[model samples]
Target chain A: MFGFCADPDTLGNVAWMACYLTTGKHMAIYLSVGTVLLLLAITAPAALAFGFAGASAARSRILPLSWLGRGYIAVVRGVPDIAFFLFFVIALDQFFEWIRHEVKCPDWDQPIRQGNDFVVCAEAKLPLGNAAQWVHETYGFFLAVLTFAIVFGAFAANVLYGAMRAVPRAQMETAEAYGMSPRQCYWRILVPQMWVYALPGLSNLWMVLIKATPLLFLLGVEDIVYWARELGGAKTARFTDYPHGDWRMWYFLALLVFYLLFTRVSEIVLDRIMKRLTHGQATSGGEAQRKAA
Target chain B: MSCLQTIADYGLRSIGIGERLLPREDFTLCQQFTLIGSGMIWNVYFGLIALLTGFFLATAVALGKASSNPLARKPSEWFIFVFRGSPLFIQFFFAYFAFLSLKSVSPIFDPFTSAWLGAAIVLFLNTAAYSGEIFYGALLSIPKGDTEAADAYGFSGLTKFRKITWPTMLRLAWPAYTNEAIFLFHATTLVYFSGFPAWRQKGDALYYANYFADKTFNPFVPYPILAGYFILVTLVIITVFGLVNRRLNRHLPQESRGRLKMRMNLIR
Candidate 1:
């Protein structure tokens, strides 16, 4: 915000619009955009780590680990991700609480699921029942982040699995012939060569991850979608100083345009990165660039 | 009541045919299956109708995007870009609000505010944009020799497109299009969860799944049921699409045929 004359009603249309945009709630909306970007920044790497583990496990020498990894990937693929969003937030919370309850409330005899309520001991409650509001909010956000990481991790695993397979056999064989162990071959040769194959799928996943941030509202993170609904609703003089009719359509339109621009910019940037990654590589893209050069 | 009785009572409950009220207490596995199974009708309806209708628009859009004329190309390009670029969740909310605004202007648009029509229209446009891009890629890849042979046979314009171009595009695009169909069906779950209200509790599978989850406070049962239903449908989709892929690629020799690999990683 800009400093202006303090009187709200006396402001002209231009000043009113400026004040409306700078209001506390609007500031929250702006901050929520950071929350989305933060989520992407955090979830992308975390999911990639999870994906690498899953992909490795799926390709493991041990049969059960491979089955477990493959099952995790397959489960998420079949279900609509929003279902997982809704389910995992609660399920994971309950799971954590159950662990806590087991340790903290060992003497308690009552079942945790009593009819409909999940009755964890107060000590087992996430963020504690008496915790500050921000604590609760942070806990919810943490759960959302984890939920996203797990679901998207499965997708990433699928991509990475394919990419790993796509690394030319001769490359791995060359690593083996040079007296490298299997682990060394995996890290030194196989992983390095898989990036070009994985980039297209990973970029697409990044876009999906970007698009999925709005579902943070469904997970109760007070993200942009939540703010859009909150601020854009019909406000009467009884509610606030800046009374206006429902402007949700305009707000949503703004969100749409934001996403469009974001995706378009990302597409351009990803294309550049893809080109850079493909340079001197064996893929078709590299061949094309080689021909052009 | 028995599972059979539960099925009888709530089998068509999603369409408001049988049960007047959803089970309020003591949730059973049968109830979860029946109610959620009942709700699959809507998902099937939305996905099938959208894919069927979107096919034609997608073809037109693909051709338009590939056209040499800027007048024809620009709009199609932007249409595909706008729809493909944004989240379908936002699209649902934005479309619902737009429909609500339109409904205020004229009662003729009243029905558009509901999930059945408004959501379907959004899904239709969204899938059309995606499938359009796929078809456009296929169109670009249509062999030069195939078209040259058509030209030699004096085929041009609509006749050439109908005879040689369109079928080849479909064949080439079929695998990607199959994935799009699966994605669309998965997306139908977002309808009720978004801005659109499920009128009188008539909603798709996820809606009932959410309802049961809310009531039972045990997500393990209902969500898995929903996932099972979805997996079954996904298999059916893959099978049906595989059949179509087979038919389209029938003219090719056995080994040269493109198999329908469900690369579910491409898009949501």
Candidate 2:
């Protein structure tokens, strides 16, 4: 923020506008975009890891693990994901606190669920009772990211599970014939080949993820959507040096444009990645390229 | 209260018909199931109406996009891109705010600020754009030979489209369109969560589910019940669409008819 923001009322139109935009709240709003991106950066990989575990679990020879994995994927499929987003975050938080309360408060005799309230000892609190503001925010954000990863991990698992199967049965058999262990067959043949198949779904999941970042606001994070509503609401003449009518429409328009551009760029990048993955592969895309060459 | 008594009081609670005040304490499993199930009426209302209306408009949009005239093509194309490109969550907020802004200029737009009309309109447009693209893709893939055969005959323009192109487009787009319908149902859950406040707590299934989650601080019960209801609805949708799909492909030979396999592709 430029320091010339002292007398917003006395300043000219362009100067006043500049100063108004440089307000502390506006700066926080600007940084919220970074928060959105940071979430995407962290959640994408986390979700991928969860998906990999899930896919691997589903494919496991062991019965319970496969059932767990398949159930994870199938159950998540039927419900609205927004329901899961709202449900899992609270459920997980409570489950964690209940565990912590049990560990820390063995002597306490009071029931944890007293009527409508979920009460716990002070130490059982997620970030501790006297934690810093940043810690609470971080904890909430962490829960949100976890929720996103879990919901989307199911989707990604669906994609990856299919992609894993899409790798021909022949390829795995050939790996076994060549004296490779099942693990070797998986790692060497299936894993590498699954990428091209997974790319389309993964890329789609990425777009859905990017679009879903707005839902962080629902989870009580000060995400871009939250800030847009906060900053864009009408400021009374008594409230600030700068008075503005309701500008939520404009704020939301900016968000729409931001998402549009993000998805457009992602599409271009994913298209390029697809081309590279398809090169010399047996798919029709690769066949066309081979014919052209 | 007995379970039957509780159901009697709260059965139509979601539509503002019964139980003016929601149950605050001593929640029963039966009460949870009854109220949430009642709330599903709104979900069905929003989804069915949106899909029903969007289906007709989507065909127009698909035809518009396929038209050689840029005048007709551009708007439909842009409509598809904007709606299909953005998240439905943001679209809901943006639409609600946009409707609010329009209210002062004309009283005609007043009802749009309400959740029922406004949210339904957004869902309608969203599904339209999604199904439009699906229809457009199907239009593009319509075999040239069929069109040529029509051309070779006296069939042209309206007659050509009515007799030949329309059936083919519907047949091709049916599978993707079915997925879009399911996705729309999933999307109706976001309506209450977005900027639109549920008028007097007359809300969708997820709204009531969220209410129970808040009250009891136990998510395990209400959410799963809601999911069960949704899965039941989804199964019904699949069956209904499968029948329609069969009808669409009825003219084709048995071997050539398309199989109605369900794929959970997120449409629009």
Candidate 3:
């Protein structure tokens, strides 16, 4: 990162620290922060879409759709989500490979599951056996994002379901009186109105999503946690320049602070958004605003 | 081996009792159930102990946050923010590493590096912070008239708290606190997965489940069994908390009593 980092062994303490911080592994750690942010950027809206679908389905008058949606929400409940994280990644991966095997290698005589090993045909591999390393990493990350979206979507559905219910019944009744169909009433009235009600819960879920990014490490992504563990482990003098004792505590401390600040900033922003949403609304917040005015 | 023999061999395996070596291959349904069920002992141990110990600290934290004194208020606020803001996953890692360093500093801190003491401490602090926030909200929402009534009755401090304020807070906070308790128990699965090593293969339910999944390369079986155990634990927690919630709300009329609802507050 700097010219003084040319020879790490000969560098002064501060320069050595700078070089160490700018090393390839450290760069990976920094890049992995971007990975965490990218995951949040992608997962938030994806989960919201899933949540909206789930909430809508759960609210459907149709019996099976409602059952499907309600079951989606209920089953994810009570169970440890880490189990989902662990289970879905493998299960989804296998499901995809199995599908690919069925389509691409119908002639393959070998059973996909032979005892403990799940051996799909070579062409049926997720990224294919011959794919670049980056493709494999991206495939893993994609699986992770999908898993996150699925799990958090269930949570969001619960929130949105409540928020939809919390919308004033009079508004929907008014819509009905105006001859709006059920679908129209839902989109034109309920969807827009539910945001204010959902904001608090959605914001709470956002914080949770932010905190959960660390779990990406468990899913085989070289995420921030992975990097922190990798780079912060004690390095022997024989290994390379800038060897140091265990610094995992410090690295984790940095991560803790990063999360703290991220959540704090998010809370402040969410508070502002909530204030804005409630500005002219008929809820208690609006009532208080009117009184203050 | 017979099912009873399997149970007798692997039932207490999680606490490092009967089995010297985990079954390696040709996994049976019986082995999965027995081993994972045995592992639930650790989960129960972690959750119950952490919840029990964290309860007192949570109350203190809640009071501190609600206190007017900045000296108390600032630390309490920060404590809640730090613990609540960060993932418990990170907390476990940070704590494990911190304990390792502490262990190096003095042999007296040796046991702190182990999951039993170290992870429990992290879970303890983590749950305390969460419950503190819940209790603080309940404190703020405590009806003003209730306190005025207490004042009129010449009650103050500990006497007033024990007689009126505490009960009201617990009653109000019970539903949310129940959700927190459930999630905290769920959060216990992350213990062995984090930096703390599960000594001698004695691990939580998720640990055994992961082992089975790895051994079998079939997540279809063990993960569901693990989830089933957790669901069972969740039901038990709800029943116990529901009983307490009922006791707390006993004075209220049947129609006016607060009902337990499962609000989705996923992850700490």
lDDT of each: 0.92, 0.90, 0.93
lDDT of 2 by residue, A163-211 (tens): 9999888888989999999889989899999999999999989988988
Q: After superposition, how far is residue A4 of candidate 2 from its true place, in Å?
A: 4.2
lDDT of 2: 0.90
Q: Residue A129 deviation, candidate 3, in Å?
A: 0.7
- Candidate No. with top lDDT: 3
Clashing pairs in 1: none
The CAPRI quality class of candidate 2 comes to medium
Alpha-carbon shift of residue B140 in model 3 (angstroms): 1.2
The candidates score, on chain A by TM-score, as follows: 0.97, 0.96, 0.97
Residue range B1-268, candidate 2, lDDT tens digits? 8999988988898888878999888999999999999999989999999999999999999989998999999999899889878888888889999999999789999999988899999999989998999999999999999899999998998999899999999999898888888888988888998899888988889999999999999898999999999899899999999999999999889998988766675423
lDDT of 3 by residue, B148-253 (tens): 9999999998999999998999999999999999998899999998988988999988999999998888999999999888888888988999999999999989
Clash totals in order: 0, 0, 0
Candidate 3, residues A112-225: lDDT per residue as tens digits? Answer: 789999999888889988899999999999999999999999999999999999999999999999999999999999999999999999999999999999999999999999
Best candidate (score: DockQ): 3
DockQ of each: 0.68, 0.64, 0.81
Residue B179 miss distance in model 2 (angstroms) = 1.2
How much of the true A–B contact set does each candidate keep? 0.66, 0.58, 0.75
The reply for model 3, stretches above 4 Å from the true place, is none
Ranking by TM-score: 3, 1, 2
